[model samples]
Target chain A: MTRASRLYRSSLLVAFAALALTAGCGKKQAAPPPPPPPPPPPPAKPTVTLQAAPTTIEKGGSVTLSWSSTNATALVIQPAIGNVAPEGSTKVSPDATTTYTITATGPGGSIDATASVNVTQPPPPPPPPPQPTLEELFARDVHDAYFDFNKADIREDAKAALSKDADFIKAHAGIKVVIEGHCDERGSTEYNMALGDRRAAAVKKYLSSLGVPADSLTTVSYGKEKPSCTESTEDCWQKNRRGHPVLAK
Target chain B: MIRQPRTPRIALKLHWFFAALLLAASPALAQDWFRTGTGLGVERPRVAVADLVPRAPEATAHGKLFTEVVRGDLDFSGILELVSPSFHPLQSPGMPLQLNYKAWSDAPASAQMVAFGNLQESSSEAAIEAWLYDVRNPSSPPVVAKVYRGAPTDAQIRKFAHQFADEIIGKLSGGLPGVASTQIAFISNRTGSKELWVMDYDGANQHALTALRTISLMPRWSPDTSRIAFACYIQAFGILSPQICMFSLELGRPVTFPRFHGSNSAPAWSPDGSQLMFSSSMSGYPEIYSIDANGSHFKRLTFSAGDSASTSPAWNPKTGQSAAFISDRGGFPQLYLMNSDGTNIRKMDLPDMGYVIDPAWSPNGQLLAFSWRRPNGNFDIYVMDVTSHQIAEITRDAGRNERPSWAPDGRHIVFESTRGGSRQIWVMLADGSHAHALTQSGANESPNWSPR
Candidate 1:
C-alpha cells in the first residue's frame, strides 16, 4: 500500500484500539436523586428586640443579660470570656468585666444583643521610679527611627519611641544618642540601607526639634538587617522596620 | 557419426558462453545491497561499491568553531559589529541585489559581508566563499578579502558563520569584532532543570555548560571566554542552599565556591578577574561582598541597619574605586553609585521611570545598561550615557526584557526576554534594533556577555 493509505489505516486501528480500551472501562454511576421538599405550616408573630446592652458595668460584679423575643422557643446567652447561662437563660457569672452577647430565638427568628462590663482594678500604692536597664540606658543615647513603607518621614509610631529616648536624654544631660535606622525585607539591600539612614536622620531631626541636642545624636542605617522579628507577618515586619536608640558608650 | 559430433560442439559452445556471463557478473556484483521497499516488490539486482571514494559528510555551517575562532580574534582585537553572510541581501535567497547606499549609510553597521556555499551529497560538507564590503565607502566594489574552507560537521556551521562574520567586521571596523563572534552565558531551564548554558551572541548554538541536576542561575562570564560563574543550589539536610560556582569551558568541570550560610548570589566579576563581587546575607543581611577568584578573602562592603545596604554591584573598570549598586536607601529599591570603600554614595537621576536595577557597564565605560520595571510591571532594558546622563529604552513590547549585559565592544547588548512564551536569550544593537531570540528550548535568563 502507499504510505498515505498505510498511515490512514494505522490511525483507524489506533482509534479502534482506543475505543476498545474505553469500552472495557465501565461508565460512571449516575448521581442519586435529590431529596423531596418539606411542606409549609406555621405562621410568624411580631416580637420586641433589644439592640444593645449597658455600655459599662463595674468589675467583679454579676450582670443579668436580657433580650425580647417572639413566638417562644429559647434564648442563649454567651459571655465573651466565661461560660454561658442556662440553656436559653440570660444570667452570667462574673470574674473580669467582659462583653456578653445574648441571642433570643423563637420559631419566628433570632436576634442578638451585646453588653460590655467594665473591669476596674483597685488602686495600688505608688511604686519607686523605674531605673533604666543598662541596655535601655545604653540604647537611650542612640536615636532609633522607623519609617513607613517606601518613606523616610517619621510616623506617629516612630515618634512615640523617639520621644521616650528624647525624655531619657534630657534627664541625663551627659548622655549622647546614636540614631539607628532600619527597614523591612521588601527591597534591595542598598536601597534599604539608605532608607534606614533616612529614617534615623528623620528621628534625629524630630528629637532635635523637641529641644534635644543635635550634636548629642548620631544617625546610621542598617537596612533590613537585625530584624526584631523574623516571622514573615505584617506585625513582625512593622516591629522590625523601626529605628532604635542605642546608647553609644 | 556426423550428428553426434555436431551436438557435442554445440554443447561446448553453450558452456563457454555461460562462463563469460559469470565473469562479467563477478566484476559488477562487488557492492552492498539492501531492499528498498516492502516485500510487495521483487528484488532488483545491483552492485555495491562500499569502499569507493570517501563518505560524503553531513553538512554544517561549523557554528561553534566559527564562533570560537571569530570570538578569539575579536577579543584580542577591539572591533564591533561582525557583518554576517545572512545579513547580506545579495546572498540571501529570493532577495534582489540592488545596493541601497543610503540605507547602509544610515545603519549603525560598520561593514557589510556576503557568503555563498553549497552542501555536499551527504549534506554534511560545505564549500563557502565570503566577501566583505566597507559600508563607509559605498562606491567601492566588495572586497574578496578572505576565503574560509572546511568540511565542518553539522554542529559547527553556526560557529563558522559567526567567525566569518567577525572577520568581515574586523576588516571593516579596523578592530577586533565585538558581539558578532562572542557567546553569551546564561541560565536555561528548558529541560526541567535550570543549568548554565552558552550560546552565540545572536542566540544560536546553545548548549548546556553545567550538569542537569543542579538549579543554576545568575551566569556571569569571565573577561576571557574560558569560564562562567553562576549561582547553584545544593540540597543539604532537606534545605536547598544557594552557592556560587564557576564552570570552565576548557575543563567542562565545575569548581564551587566555599559554602556560606544563607543565600549567596548575584555574582559580577571585576574587570581584572581577580575578585568576584556578590550579595550575601552572611553578615545577617544581603550586603555587597567581594571574594577572591579562588573564593577566599571575603569582605563586607556596607554596614547598614535593617541589614539593607547594597546588592547587584557592577564594578567600574576604569577607576575600580567606585561601583554601581541597587539599594533601598530611599525606601524603594533604586540604583545608586558608591565609592569602592562604600562611601561617596549618590542616587542616579533616572527618568520618570522607577524601579531600576541590574546595572551592566559597557566595556568602554561610556554607558550603563540596566533593566527597569516599567509602569506596566514589565521589565525592559535601558541604556544611560554616563557623561551626558541621557537615558534611552533599548527594548519594548518584548515581555520582560531584562538582565542586559553589554558586549565587550559596547555596540551591542545581550539580555533575556520572555517574549516568545518562554524566556530566551536575545541580542540587539545597543540602540534597541535587530532583536531576535537565540535559544530554541527552555526558559533562559541572566545573560552575561563575554568581554571579547
Candidate 2:
C-alpha cells in the first residue's frame, strides 16, 4: 500500500510540474522580486553644536551658552542648568573655571558637547605706606649749623643751614624746639659754657630774624660737656662745635 | 775765718738770741714765698727729721705716723732740703740732754738742724713734745719746742704733726708757712653725684659738702673760705637748668640762690666776698652779672649784644679795682680787662693768635695764669705778666693740662690733667715741677684752691 501511495504522489508532482512549466512559457518574464526594504536611513544621527558667547569672563560675570542639535528629541545642560530646549541660547554665570556640558538624546543615540569658560581675578594690592611720626618729621626737617674754633659767631658757610632751620621752625605750627649750643674740647668748661650760649643765641637770633617767634624757640648750652664728636683732630672739633636743634620733649 | 770755740760766754749770748727768735714766731718777716717780699736768698737748709720716740709701748704706731708726716711736710716746704733718713743715727735721742750732736753734724749725716719728738699716749688722749735743734751749735736753744696735747685719734695726731712741722718751717724759712692745713674745693662724683667736695692740700681728709643729687661743677671758694659757689643743675621751670648755687661749709647746708630763666654758671667771688660774679643768658645773651653774697643786689656788668658773650670773671684780689674775664667779642675767646663797673674794656692780645680763656689773677695782682690753646699746641697752663704781656708756658706735652689754680703759697698750682689716662686733680710747682695727682678715685675736674 505504501508503494501504491508513493507512486500516486509522484504522478501528481509530475502533473503539477508540467502544468507550471506550460504557464511560464505562455507569459512575458515576470519582474524580479523587490529587494528587502533598507533600514529607515539610520534615523539621522543627533548632531550637536555647543558654544559659549564671550568664552572668557571675569569671576561673578555672566556668559551666554548656545547649543543646536539636529534630529534630537530631547536636550539638557549639565553643571546646574538641566533640561534645556534644543537649538537655543541661555546665559550662565560660572563662579570659577568651569566646563558646561550639553547632552542630546534621540532615537539614534546620545551626544555630549562641552564649552569651557576661563575666569580671571586681579592681584591683591600692597598695603598703604605707614605715616611718619611727628618726632621723625622734625628730625628730618631740622638741621644743625657748625661754628669755627672758639668762635660762637655764625660763619658764612653756616648761614644756609641756619636759614633752613629757621624755615623748619616756622613751618611747623605750635612746635617748639631747643637750640643747643655746643663747643669743642679745646676750651675750658666755664669758657665753653659761655661760648655755647652765644652759639645758641646766634641761631635763635637768625631764626627770629626769619620770622620765628622767640617763645617757640629756647636755648641751652651744652658747652664742652656734650661733644657731638669725640676726637683729638681738627675735623672732629669742627663737628663738635655746632648749634644743634632738638625737638622739645 | 776761724770757727768760734765753745766758750761759756759765747754760749750764753747765742742762747738768748736764738731763744728770742723762737719766741717771736713772726710771719711778718720779708721772706714769705707768697708775699713777693725781700727773700733771705740763703741756701736751702739741710735738716733731718728723726723718728719720734714712743714714751709708751702702745704709742709706737702713732709716733711713726708723726715722724713720717713731719718729714714729708719739711721736705715739701720748698725752702728746705731733707737729709736722707738712711744717714740718720741708729739711736733715737731720748731727750735734748741725751742728743748726739756729733753724729748728726758729721759728714754722712751732714744735717745743720734736727727735729726730734716723743709721743706719749693714753687710750683716748695724746701729748707730743717736739723740738727742732741746731745740731752744729749744741749749746743753742731749740729752734722749735712745742707741746701739743689732744685726742689720740688719727685726725688729732695729724693736726699735732702739722703744728710741729709749721713751727719748724716758720722758724727755719724766716716766715713762710706750710700749706699742710689748707683745703682744696673741687667737683667730684665719688658719691654717685657731682657734688662739691673738699680735701686737705695734701689730698687727705676728703669729704662731700653737698647732697644736691644733681650735677655740680666749677666750684669757687669764697675769699674767706667759708662758702662755695658753683654751677648746680637745679629744677627751674620744670627743667633741669644750670644755676648758681651756694653751699656753706660752716653751716653744712645749701644756701638759696635766685633762680634765673636761662643758663647761669661759672661763679667767681669778689676779693672781699661781698659779691658773686657769674654769666647768665637770661637776657638772650650770655653776659657778666654781679649779685650780692646775701642774694639781694643784682647788677649786670657786661652789655655784650647779639652773639657776643663775656663771662668767667676773675677779680684782682689785691687791687679789687679791675677784673679779668673771657670774651668772644673779637672772634676767639680772649682775655679782657674791665673796670669793676664794666668800664675801660681792653683786650689782652698776645704775640700769636690763639684761644685764651680761664684767666685767673695772681695774688700779687701782677701775673695772670690761664689756659691757652696755641695754634700749634694743646691747651696748656700759661702764666702772663699782666703789665709786660710776657707769656710763659708752664705745662708742656702733659696731656691737656688746664684750669690752673694758684695755691695760697703762689709757688704751687693745682689743675686738671689727663696725663694719668683720665681727668684728675693734679698739683705741681708753679714752674711745672713735682707734679703729683691729688685725685685718682673718680673723674675729678676744675680744682679751686682755698683762699687760706
Candidate 3:
C-alpha cells in the first residue's frame, strides 16, 4: 500500500472511536438528573393533606378537624373540647344534621370522605281557650306580683300573668277591683299586713303597666286575715301569700 | 209582877226544871253568864266585825268584805275599834240578821260588818250585800251597801271587796267614788292571734274584738265605744304593708283607710273622731300626717331630715293645738312635742331613758302615758305630768312593756308586755296599782284604751 493511503485510513479510525465515547458519557448524565428531582417531591405529600382539612370542614356545624400528612410526627388538634382523643375520634356537642367531610393523610398521599344528614322540626300544638272567673282573675294578678326565691321585683312569669289580667280589666271597663294583699301565717299580723300591702301595691303597679286604669284598682292589705285555707302547710302558705281582687260595691 | 200557884211536890219539881231550861235559853241569862270582868274594873267586852259574818277558810289576801267594811265603817265613825277574830274569837254564823248580838259583844271589837254574796265564774260582775253595825249599841240599825257588780271571778272577789271598802272610806271622808265599774280595752294576742280585748277595769270579762290574721298592734279607741282604730300590716304586692285601719265594733267589720305610700301606723284620733293623725312614710320617711274621716285629704304635718320617722302621735283634746310624738331625728328615738300644724317642735329631756315611744294624752290633758325604754334594753310604761314633766314608771320587771294608753276616765292605763314569753296585754291603775294580765294568747302589742 502507498504511504498516503495508509495515513488516511488511521485518521478515519480515530474519529470513529472519539464519537462512540462522547455518546456513552451523554447517556449516563441524563439518568442521574431525573432520579434527584423525584426524591425531593416525596416530602411535600404531608402538606397536601393539611391543605385538604379546611375543605372537609366546609359549612361547619358540630365538627372536629384534624391533619396528619404534613409530617411523620404526631397529629395535633387545637382548642380541644375535653382532652386529646384518638385521630378521627373527637366528638362535638349540639350536633346539627348537616353534610360533613373527613380528611385522612399519610407520608404517601392524602384522601377525603363526605357524609350527609337531614334536618327537620316537629309541629307545635294549638292554644287553649280563655276561662274567666273572679277568683281565677285575682289569682292571676297575685301570681304576677311577686318573684321567686332570692328575686326582688316581678319576674317574667308574673308579668305574663299580669298581662292577662290587664287585658281582662281593659275588656271589662265597669268592673272596679280592690286588690287585697295577704301573707302567710308565719309572721306577726302587723308585719304580715304590711307585706300583704306591698304585694297588693305590686299587683296594682303591674296591672297599670299592662294598661289597666290605675283608678280602677285600689290597693289594701288584709295582713294574715281571710286565709283561703286555715292550715299550716307549705302549700297553704304559698296560697295564703297572695293578693286577691275583689269587686268594689 | 208576882205569881203564885200551889202544886204537889212532884208537879212543882217538874215545873222548876222547865223554868230553869227556859232561863238557860234567855238572852239576858246567856249574856250574864258569858260576861267577864277585867282587872281594870269590869272592862266592856270587845267585839270583832269579822266574827259577825260568814267567811271562807281563810281571809283573802287583800281582806274580805266583812273585815274591810267593818274596818272602814269604824274608821269613818272614829268611835269604834275592831280586833282580829284570831285573838278574840266570836262565832256568829248564817246571814247578818241571824247574828247573835251577845256573842258579837263578847268579841274584842266595838263594831262589826256583815257581808254575803255568791261568787260565780261564768259572769264577770258580782252581786254583794254588806252591812255595818256597832256592837256597843245593839239597838242601832245596821248600815248597808248593796253592790251589784256584774260577775267577778274568785281572784277578783278580794279586789271587789277592797272597792267596797274604798267606797266606805269615801263616804266617811266625805266624797270619793269607789274604784269599781270601770272597763279597760287592751290589745291581746289570744286565740292564736292579736286582737283588741275588753275587760272589767279590775281584769275580768275579757273578750277579743279584732279578727286579724297578722299582728294587730297599737290599738286605739275612738271617743265613742262604737269603733276602734289599730295598726296592722296587710299583704300588698307580695310584701307586708303597714296600715291604720278602723273597725266599727257595732258593724262587725273593718274598714281600712287610705294609707300613704309608705308605713301608715300609730294612729291617734282627734277628740271629735272627725280626723285621725298617724305616722306615715309617704314623703320618703315617716312623718306625722292627718287624714279626714273619709280618707279624702291627707295633710302632711311635719318635714325633717335624717329619716325623721315619727311614731305614736298624741293629740291634746283640750288645747286642740298641742301634739306629742316619737321622733328619731336625734340618732335615737325621743319624745317631741309640737303644735298641731307641725310648728314649735321641741324635744322632751327624759334623762336615763334611752328611747321613748307611743305617747297617749290623758283625757284631761294633765298628763301623758308613754313607753320609755331604759338603757338596759328594757321597756316600761311611764306617766309624765305635762306641767312639771315629772315622770313616774308604772311597770317593773314587765318585759318590753310598751304602747301605754290612758283610759277614758283617766284612772287606768293599758299597755302591752312580753313578760309571759309572749306579748300580752296588761292594765294598771293610774298610780300604778293593781296591775293584772288581760291577755293570754298570741303576740299582743300596742294597746290603746278606748276614749269612752
Candidate 4:
C-alpha cells in the first residue's frame, strides 16, 4: 500500500494504535541500563628498596642492612637471616663482600631491588733481610773444637777455637748454632751416641759460660756413624773426635 | 812309626783309656763346667747335626734346607758348637733307626749329641721327624724326638728347623729356649730411607716392619714382645721432630700416646710392662721421663737445671728397680745408675775411657756391657762386672763394635760391627769370642734382640 493512502485508510486504525501504544506505554518498559563506567585501572605494583650502610669496608668489618617494601604481607632475607618485617634494618658482619636483595609482593604483582658492599684487603708486609746460609757460617766463620779420644773436656786449643766461634756467632744477633759431637770408629753404637751428645753438650756449656745465649745453642750426636776421616789410623780418628759447630736456621 | 800289636795286655790298657776319654767328654761331665769356675769362659757343648735324611726323593731339596737351618741355629746358640758335616761318617744316617752311635763318636765328629731328622714331603707340605741322640749312650732314649708338619717352602722349612733347635737347646742347656726362633729388630735404609725391620735370629726373612718412609731409630721391644717403641721423625708444624712412637705388632699399625711439646725419644719399657721410660726435651733440656703404659702417670725422672742432658734410659729386665742411663752431668757422656723411683742417682763405676756410653744390663743382673773409647779414639766393647767392677774387653781390633744386647739366656750377645767393610749385625759369646755375622748384607745397625 502507498504509504500516504495506507496512512489515510489506517487513520482510524492509527487512533486505535495510539490508544494501544498509550496502554503499552502505561506498562513497565524493558531496557539495558547504561554500562557502568569501565573499572579504574588496577593499583600499581608495590615497590621495594634494600640498602647497606658502609658500602666498602676492610676485612672483619660489619655492615647495616636496611629494607623498605609496600603491599607485602611477609618478607625474608636469604642465607641465614630468615624472616623480617616489610620495613626494617639489621646489622651484618660478612667476612667477604656480599649483596642483599629485597622483594615485595601484592595483588597488583611483585617487585625486587638489591644493594651491595665492597671490601678491600690490607697490603702485604715487606720481605725480610737476606740470611746467611749454614754453609757460609760453618765454612767462613765457625771452627770445630778438637777433643781427645773419648773426651768431652775442652782442651786449651779447643778453647781458642771455640772462643772464635762464640765471637762469630754472637756478632750475628739472630744466628744460632748447633754443636755436633762426633766420635771415631770405636765403641758400642748406643754408647757412642750418648758420648757424642755429651761432647756437644760440653761444648755448648762452655759456650754458654762464655756469655753466649744458652738458648742459642743446641747439641747432637753423630756417634761413630759419621766419621770425618775414613782411615783406621790414629791421626784420622783424632780429627774425627771433635765438636763441630754448624749454623742453625 | 812301627806298630807293636798282638799283645792282650796292651789292648786292655787301650780299652781303659778310651773309656776314660768317653767319660770326660760326657755332657754330664761338662754340665757343671759353667758353674764350676768364674763362669767367664766355659767350653761350649759339641753337637753334631746329621744331614736331614729324606723319606722320599721329592723331599731332598727341603731336607737340605732344613738341615742347613738347624745347623745354623745350633751354631748361633752360643751354648753349643756344630760339628761340621765334613766330619760325619761315610754311611748316611737315613733314619733314627739306622743312626750309628759309633759313627758319630768317631774322630773329628765326636759329638756329645747328634741331631737327626727325617723328612717326608709331598707337593706342598712336609712332615719332619727330629730326634736328638746322646751319642755317648745310644742305648738311652733320644733327648728330643718331635714330628712337625708344615708347608715345605723355604720359610716353613726354616721355621720347623728353628722350632726343633729350640727344643734341643732347652733340653740341653736347662735355661731359656734358644733365640733361634726369636727375631731381631733393627734399622735399615735399604728402602732408600731409614725404617724399622725385623728378621729371623739368623738374619733370614728380613722385612720392614715400619714403612713410615721416614727416619726411625732404636726399636726397643716391650718386655711382653707385643709392641715396639721407637723414635720416629714426624712432621709437626712442618718441622721434622723426633717423637716416641709405638707400633703394635698384633694390631699391625701405629698406636697413639700422649704427645709432649718437644722431642720425645729413646723409649724403653719397664721390666714389668707397667711403664715406659723415655727422654723428653719438654723441660728445655733432654731429660728422663716416665709414663704409665696407658699414658696416665706422667713423671719426670730427672730434674737437671740448665743445659745438662739426661737420656738413654735402660731398665733392668728383671725387677725394673734400677736403670742405666747416659748423662752429661759429667764432663762427658757417662753411664749413670738410678732407682726406678728416680732417686739415689750415682755415677756408674766405669773405666776412665775418654767417653763411655750405651750400657746394656745382663739378664742375670751381673754385668753391664758398654762401649769405651780410648784416648787414641779406639772404641771397644768392655763388659764390667757390676759387683767386682772388673772390666774385660769383649772386642778388640774389630771394626767399631757397639750396641751390645744380651740374649735372653745371658750367654750370648747381639751387637753391631763394621769389621766386614759394612756395619752389620753380629752374634758372639758373651765373652766376645766366636764373632759371626748375623746379617750378611746391608748396613744394619741398632739391633735389639727380642726377649722371647
Candidate 5:
C-alpha cells in the first residue's frame, strides 16, 4: 500500500516539475520555488521481515526467529529481543504465545513486520488409563459356575457364568488359566477330588465348545480340601461346589 | 502237624490228656479256609485258647504275649467265636499230658476245640510248642501241634505267636490261610512326615519304611510283599513332581524307579508284579499308565478323549484280563472297566447320578469296591458286583467313608474314614460289619490293603 501511494505521488511530482520549468521561462504570476526534480524512483522504502521457523511450539519448546531488512539504517525487535543486525536469526523459547515485531528505520520512514510464536501446554498427557491387573480382570471377566450337591452337570446359572467366561477367555487369547473344581465338605476327600475334577471338566468342555482354546486350560480338583466357605449351611456348601477359573502363571 | 495222637505211650489219660509232639509246617488247606472266609458257613464254632504256659520263670512275659495274641487273632478270625478268658478253666494244660478234655468241654469253658501252648525262652533263643485239639473227641487225635524256635527278641516272640495263631486259623477254617503273619503297608505321619509304614495285620509293630520327609500315599504291597509301590511327592530333575515311588522291603531302602513327567501318582502293581499301573499327567491330563516293575517298559493304559482325567487302575487279581479304574469321561467320575492292555473300555454306569472314585478290585475279581458320593448323600464305600453290576453301599452315614480296598481274603475291606473326628484307617468285614479303626492318630488316609 505504501509503495502504490509513493509511486502515485512521484508521478504527480514529475508533472509539477514540468510545470515549474514552463513557469521559469514565462515568469508568470510569482511562481513558487520549483521543487527539486523527483528521482527516477521513490527512495527505496525500508522493508522489514521477521519470521519464526516454527509458528507453534510446546510450552518447553523453542523456535528460530529470523529477520531481515532492506534499505534500513537500524533495526530492532520487540518482546525482550532488542536491537539486532539487518539480517540475523536467534532461537527464542517462550512460555506463552508472543508476537515479535521488527522495526526497520531509514531515510524514507520506519516499517514494522511481525511473526507470531504460539506456545501451548500440550493437553496434559491423558492421565495414564488405570490399567486393570490380570487378577482383577479375572475377577471381573471370569466367573465361577456353581453346582448342586454331588452334581457336575452345568446348571442354567452356571451356563450364564460360563458364557461370560468363554467370552473373556476368547477375548484374551494369550491368557492361560486353571479351572479349579472345588467340592463341598460333604463329600469324601478322595471322591470329592474326582468330583471336583468333574465340575472343572464340565466347565472346560463348555468353554471349549464356546471357542476357548483347549490347550490354554488346565483342570485341578481341590475337592473338599479347599473350601471357600466353612460353615455347615447349604449356602456355604454351594459356594464350595463351584468351578472357578483363575489366571495361570 | 500231628494228624494222630502220639503221646499215649508217653502218658496215659485218666482225666489227664495224652501227649503229642510234632514240629512240622503244614501246607495250607485253602479250600477249607476259603469256605469259612467266604461267609457261607452254617455255624461258627466256639474255640478256647488257653493261656500260654511259661515253662521257665524267664519265659512268663513271652507266654502272656503269645496267649493274648492268639486270643485276639481268633476274635477277629470271622470263622469262629473265641471263648472269653473269664470262662476259661483256672488250670490250663501246660502240655497234652496235663490236659483234662472234659473240663474244656464242660459248662464254664464249653469250648468245642481247645488250643494250648507253652513257651520256653532262653537268653539266646525262644521256643514254643502249640497244640489244638477237639475237646469233644480228645481221645481221637490232635488237630494241630507245632513247634516254633527263633531268636529271643520281642519281635521273634511276636512272630512265633503269629505263626501259632495262623496255624490254628488255617486248620480251623478248613484251609483258608490266616492273615496273622501278613503285614499291612500304609501311610503314617506319626514321625512328622508322610512316610510309608508297615504294621502287623492286627495293628502292631508299626515302623516307617520311607523317611523321605515328603508326602507318600496309597501304599500297595507287591504280590510277593517285597516292594511297596506308592504315590510320592518328590523332586525329579529339580522340579516338584508327583511320581510313583517304590520302597523295597527286602532291600530296606527306597529303590529308584523311572521318573516320568508331570504329576504321576496313585500307583497300583499288576497282579503278577511284572508291571505297575499308575496315574500320570505327563500327557497333559491324568491318565492311567503302566511301567514295568523294574521301571523299563512304559505303556499308556488309558486314553480318554480330550483331556479326561482317568486314574486309579486296579487289575483283577484272579483274571488279569481286565482292570477297574475311575474315569470322568461320562461327565462325572464313574467306575470303568478296561482290558489290561488298555482295550475294551466300558463304563460301569450306576442307577444314580453321583461321583464314583477309587475303584478297587476284590481279590476274586468278582467285585469292585469304591467310594461313591451319591446325589442325595456324601461319600460312602460301595461294592459293585462286576458280573451283575449290582451295587451295594457298604458304608453309610459314617463321616465320609472312602477308598475301600478289599483285604486279601476278599471278605474284608480297609478304608479311610473321618467318623472318628479325624481321618483314620478302618477295617470291616466285606458286609460292613465289625467296623474298627486300625489307625487313630495323625490324619491317616488312603488305606490300601496289602495283597498278601
Candidate 6:
C-alpha cells in the first residue's frame, strides 16, 4: 500500500511543477532602477593667510597684522592678537620676537597660518650728544615767581618773570620742566598741598598760554615741606611762597 | 582675703553688713563724684591704679610698666585723677579676692574705683588677672574681672595696660570705651621717603606700615580701623602720578590702587565706612571727589575749576550729614561746608585767621578742628563750635601745628607739629592741653586717629 501512495504523490508534484512554471514565464517588469548618487565631493578646505606689515621693526615700534580667510566661520590670532574677523587687520606692538598664529575654523575643520615679527634692539642713541652744560643756564633762565600770603594767584610782578621763563622754555623746546608749588609755613600740610597744586596749575596755565607745550610741563606740590626760608619773618615767608621751576631730565 | 578663716558665721555677718553699708553709700557718692579731671565744670572721678602684684618676681619690671601705662592712660583720658600709689592702703590688692575695697574708699585717697591685677611672666608670654572694683560698693562684685595673656614685652605690657584702662573707662563712663587702645596713623620720612607709620595712642610701638619707598602722605584710617588710606606717588605712563592707595591691616598689603585718570590725594573715609573722600585732578583740576569703599561710584563733590580749587574734605562722622573742606573760591583757602551729597554749599563762619585748612570734624559732630595760619605765618590748631561758631585754640606758639585729627572718643585730638624741633605727630586732650609727642625719630606728620 505504501508503494502505490508514493507513486500517486510523485505524479501530483509533477503536475503542480508544470502549472507553476507556466505562471512564472508570463510576469512583466514595472520600471528601471534610479541611478546611484555621485561620489561625495572632497570636503571644502578652509584657507587662511596672515601677514605682518613691516615684519621687522625696532624695539618699541608697532606693526600691522592683516589676515584673510575663506570658507571659515571663525578666526582667531594667538600670542596676544586675540579674536579677529575672518578678513581684517590690527595694530600690534610686540615687545619681543613673537610668532603670531592665526587659526580659521569651520565645519570642514581648522586651518592655521603664522607670521613672525622680529623686534630688533635699537642701537644706543649716540650717548645723548654729551648733554649740554645747561643746568646753571636753565636755572638762571627760570626764576622763582612769588605769590601773596595765602594766595595762589600769580602776583602782578611775577608775570614778567614768568614771561621770560616761558620765552626760555619756548627757546628750548626739547627741555621738560617741573613747576614746584611751595607754600609758606603758615597753613595745614594737607591744605598747603592743595594750595601748592593750585599755584603750580596757575603757572602751568600761564606757560601753556604762552605757547609752552602742556605735555612738557608737569606740576608737583611741595606744600610747606621745602621752605626756601625757615624764619618766621614776613620776608622769609614771602620767599617761601614761590613757584620755582625744576628741570626734568 | 578674710583674715579669720575659721569664723564662718562671723564672716557671713560681716559680709552682710558691708553689703548694706555699700548700698547706702554708693548712690550719693558714685553719681556726683564721677569726674573727668578736665575740670570743665565736671568733677574728676577719683580712681586708683595699684601697682600690679608680681606673681613672678622677675615680672616686677613688666608689672611696673603695666601700672605706669595704665595710670598714664587714665590720667590722659581727662576723666579720672589717679590716686597716687603712695596713698594706696597697706593691704594692697593683688587679686579681686584680696581687694580692700573699704580701705580704698576711705581717707584722703578715697578712690571710688580701684584697678588691681596679678602679673606672671614666662619667657615669652605673660598671664594677667586684671580687676576693676567699685570701691564705693565694698560688697559688690568687681565691675571688671578678666584675664589677659600676651607676650610680655614692653609693648605688650603697654598694650595690656591700655586695654585695662579702656575697660575701666567703659565701666565708669556709661559704656563709653576710652581711646587708650587706639592707634594713630601718621606720615614719616624715617626711611628716606615719606611713608605711612602707626603708633599706639600713647606713642608706643611706632612702626612703619608701608614699604612703598615713595612719597607717601596723609594717612587716614577707615572707620572700621581695618585700612589706612594714604597718598602715594606711583609711576604710571612713565610719569610720577599721585594716587590714593590703602594699606589693609588684615590683608597685610595695599588693597587699593584707586588709579583715577589724574592725581589723587588726601583720602578721608566716610563715617559709615561706605565711601572715601579724596582730592582728584582727573577733571583737569584738583577737586574734592567721593568714591565708595571698593573704589567704584566716583562722584565729584567740589566743582571749582582753574585756580579756584577745592580739596581736603572731612566728612562728618556722627550724622554723615555735612562735610568740612578747604576751598579757595574766595581767593584764600578757608573752611567751607556742604552736604554729604555735595549740595548746599556754604562758607563757614571762620575768623580772619589768614587761612584755615585741614578741617577735621569731631566724632560728635560738635566741633571742627583745623590749622589756622596767622598773618605771622605761624600755623596753630584751632577748633570751632559747629553750632555757635565759637573758636577755641588748641595750640598757640607751637612751632607750625597742623593736621588735627580727633580720636574716636571725641575727647582727644592728634596732630602734627614742628613744636618739638621737627615735624612730629602729637596727641593732646581735646582742649589742646597735655600735648605729647607720639613720634620721635623721624619727621612725622598728618596723624589720623583710628575709630576704635
TM-score of each: 0.50, 0.75, 0.49, 0.65, 0.67, 0.72
Best by lDDT: 2
Fnat for each model = 0.11, 0.80, 0.04, 0.17, 0.07, 0.54
- The candidate that achieves the highest TM-score relative to the unseen native structure: 2
- Point out the worst 10-residue segment of candidate 5 chain A by lDDT: A187-196
How many angstroms is residue B401 displaced in model 3 relative to the true structure, after the best TM-score fit? 2.7
TM-score of chain B of each: 0.70, 0.89, 0.65, 0.89, 0.89, 0.87
Give the residue spans of candidate 4 off by over 4 A: A1-249, B1-46, B101-112, B135-139, B236-238, B257-264, B303-309, B350-354, B374-377
lDDT of all predictions = 0.60, 0.81, 0.58, 0.76, 0.78, 0.80
The lDDT of model 4 is 0.76
Off by over 4 Å in 1: A1-249, B1-144, B147-151, B212-214, B235-239, B374-377
In model 6, what are the clashing residue pairs, if there are any? B35-B43, B35-B44, B35-B45, B36-B79
TM-score of 5: 0.67
Sort the predicted structures by TM-score, highest score first. 2, 6, 5, 4, 1, 3
Per-residue lDDT over A71-173 for candidate 6, one digit per residue giving the tens place of the 0 to 100 score: 8888989987678888999999998999999999977789999999999989877765565567877977789889987787887788999999999988987
Per-chain TM-score of chain A in candidate 6 equals 0.47
Please give the TM-score that candidate 4 achieves against the real structure: 0.65
Least lDDT summed over 10 consecutive residues: which range in candidate 1 chain B?
B45-54
lDDT of 1 by residue, A1-249 (tens): 756567667766776676566556677645334323223334454343433234344554555555556654655556553333223234444566666666656676766666666666656658887997866655545444556676777788767777877787888786766665678855443345445655666677788898898777765555664577777688877876777776765
Model 3: per-residue Cα lDDT over B116-139, one tens digit each: 332222333444455545444568
